[model samples]
Target: MESSLATSQMSDEIVCFCGQSSVTRTSLTANNPGQRFRSCSFYGQPDAWDYFSWVDPPPHPRYKAIINKLLRKDNSKRNDEQQLRRLVKCYQIALEVFLLGVIIQKIWL
Candidate 1:
């Protein structure tokens, strides 16, 4: 019974944080593409991340600065605020999903 419970937790079980149904599975490739051992499902797929800003490559020197400046609460610019809020919200959602994956991994594995 204990082992079965563990196995069930290891399987792709989706539980939403907000009392809704979680629809996505946790996969290393979906979470981290830069890792050479993983395959990105959206690799080379057009319109994959339609809303995210295109950072030509990861580890760009200006990327963090851009994100910070855009996220500044004091910034009165409408476009900057909108972009920052959207990105931040998306980040928060992804974080919740990732953390959920970790917890489930621990409980049932």
Candidate 2:
């Protein structure tokens, strides 16, 4: 409930990139779109959301700790992506080496 209120306070009504203030229900039907919800129809696009940079805006001190934790979590995600890529490359290399070894053994034996 608190998060919902935050989102509501953060979001505002504005014309969409298409110059339409409201989109039809058919536009958002697949991604939680329905007659009850209003959307800009460009909700799926990253650029569809308005950007608001906090320029020296003050926040609760507790949020500072939360921000640090979130940054750590973001760094961990990068490490995880890197590890996953390495695993995939290692698997491919191992498979290729195994095939080459099999070919050599068959030819010699």
Candidate with the greatest TM-score versus the true structure? 2
lDDT by residue for model 1 (1-22), tens: 0111111255554322222222
User: What are the clashing pairs of model 1?
Assistant: 6-108
Error of 1 at 44 (Å): 48
TM-score of candidate 2 against the unseen true structure: 0.43
Model 1 steric clash total: 1
C-alpha TM-scores of all predictions: 0.30, 0.43
Candidate 2 lDDT tens digits, 1-109: 0111112233564444454453434322222222243455554466564322222334445755566566668789999999999999999999999999999999999
**Relative to the true structure, how large is the alpha-carbon lDDT of every model?**
0.43, 0.53
Q: Assess candidate 1 and give its lDDT.
A: 0.43
Model 1 / residue 53 / CA error / Å: 45
Q: What is the lDDT of residue 86 in candidate 2?
A: 100
lDDT score for residue 25 of model 2: 40
